[model samples]
Target: MDWNKAADNAQTLMQAHEALSRLMPRPDAPQQTWLAYYRRSAAVYTRVAEIDRGHFHETMFWATREREKAEAMEQSALA
Candidate 1:
């Protein structure tokens, strides 16, 4: 794996996560229901960053874990 590319991708993913986080709904916003959407987006980018760090199989495992967490959070929010 090219470390340079991996580093660049990680940076990009982190940046995207930051951007998505910034778009989260305000505390009193009526659209607060959408916060989970933003959180999941950020978590997805975080998983991509982990994969980009050259962890391959490990990253995949953690990504799946994170996805499960996001799904549970989303479901709880809906409930």
Candidate 2:
């Protein structure tokens, strides 16, 4: 497996997560709404990280899949 490619993709996912995190609602927004939004976003990042960590001793197929899942989660949150 190409370790460098996996690293690059992992970095990309991390960056996307950071970008999404920065888009959080303002501080004055309803507490429940803000918490719910961030909770879902955090779950995606946590799942992606879990998959990437598992790939340390195996293959790296799930990174992309998790990234797609993250994107879908973000889109669903937006909707």
Candidate 3:
């Protein structure tokens, strides 16, 4: 993937993490939502660490996949 695409995906993941963190303390929130958010954040952070260690392709692949999944979950929450 191009650098722009990777950056956008990373940003999306970061935003998702932020949203999830905000929702965490709400008593009415579903448990699965928190778990999904945690997994998404872990995936993004892991990919970022890999990039810092010089693993570009692995970083891009994981970021793209996880960001897509996170975005889907976010949309589902909206619905």
Candidate 4:
């Protein structure tokens, strides 16, 4: 196996995942759009945490982070 090729593939996958994770509905979307995105992301992480007990903490952390982002959006809207 070519270690360099394997590492390159892994890095590419991570970059792709990161890009997907940061995707929004649009470049100048409303607060509601951002809120929906974050809440949906939290739901996905929460479900994964329940299914993958071995990584519950990590998954829940992501879920919490997503929820926090959503809350921040809501708070910003209220302010």
Candidate 5:
């Protein structure tokens, strides 16, 4: 497992999360933007979960404790 690759992926995921968060509705905005942002955020979160699962499985093959940590991170992200 390449730590660099994992770090890069984490950065990308965080950026997506930030972008989606900014799209949140404002009092003066239309309802459609709010709905769109919600859907987009959901999709981003799903992608993050998938990435996390993959990372967890890959790391688990080498270290059980690392796997557990990864799984916890994935669960926290979902929650």
Candidate 6:
């Protein structure tokens, strides 16, 4: 196996999660900000899915869930 690549993926995943947490919204952020956050989250998970490729569906599932959240947020913003 490609140990170096695996290590790199692990590190990247950690950094991505940390960055996501740092970007977490405060209580009063505007809808546009929330929408952007959700979209960024979806993109993150999508990259994770790509990085984890074929190990299982978990990453893709998370990606799908994130995208759903983004969609819901967008719908709410339009309402």
Question: Which predicted model would earn the best lDDT?
Answer: 6
Candidate 4 structure quality by residue, lDDT tens digits, 1-79: 1113222232232332353355546767777777877886676667666666777787778778889999998888889
Better model by lDDT: candidate 1 vs candidate 6? 6
Q: What is the per-residue lDDT of model 6 for residues 45-74, given as tens digits with 9 covering 90 to 100?
A: 677766656532665666677788889988
* Candidate 4 overall lDDT versus native: 0.62
- Cα-lDDT of candidate 1: 0.51
Task: Show how many residue pairs clash in every candidate, following the order shown.
Answer: 0, 0, 0, 0, 0, 0
Residue-pair clash count for candidate 1: 0
| Candidate 3: regions farther than 4 A off | 1-53
> On a 0 to 100 scale, what is the lDDT of residue 75 in model 1?
80
Q: What is candidate 1's TM-score against the reference? A: 0.38
TM-score of 3: 0.37
Q: Could you give candidate 3's per-residue lDDT for residues 40-67 as a string of tens digits?
A: 5556556565545555555566556656
Q: How far is 41's C-alpha from truth in model 4 (Å)? A: 0.8
Q: Estimate each model's TM-score.
A: 0.38, 0.40, 0.37, 0.66, 0.41, 0.67
Model 1 clash pairs are: none
Expressed as tens digits, the lDDT of each residue in 6-78 for candidate 1 is: 3234444445445445554566655334545444554555557555665445545544554675677668879
Please give the distance, in angstroms, between residue 11's alpha carbon in candidate 6 and its true position after superposition. 5.7
Q: Model 2 Cα displacement at 62 (Å)?
A: 19
Clashes, model 2: 0
Indicate which candidate wins on TM-score: 6
- Which model, 2 or 6, shows the larger TM-score? 6
TM-score (C-alpha) between model 5 and the true structure: 0.41
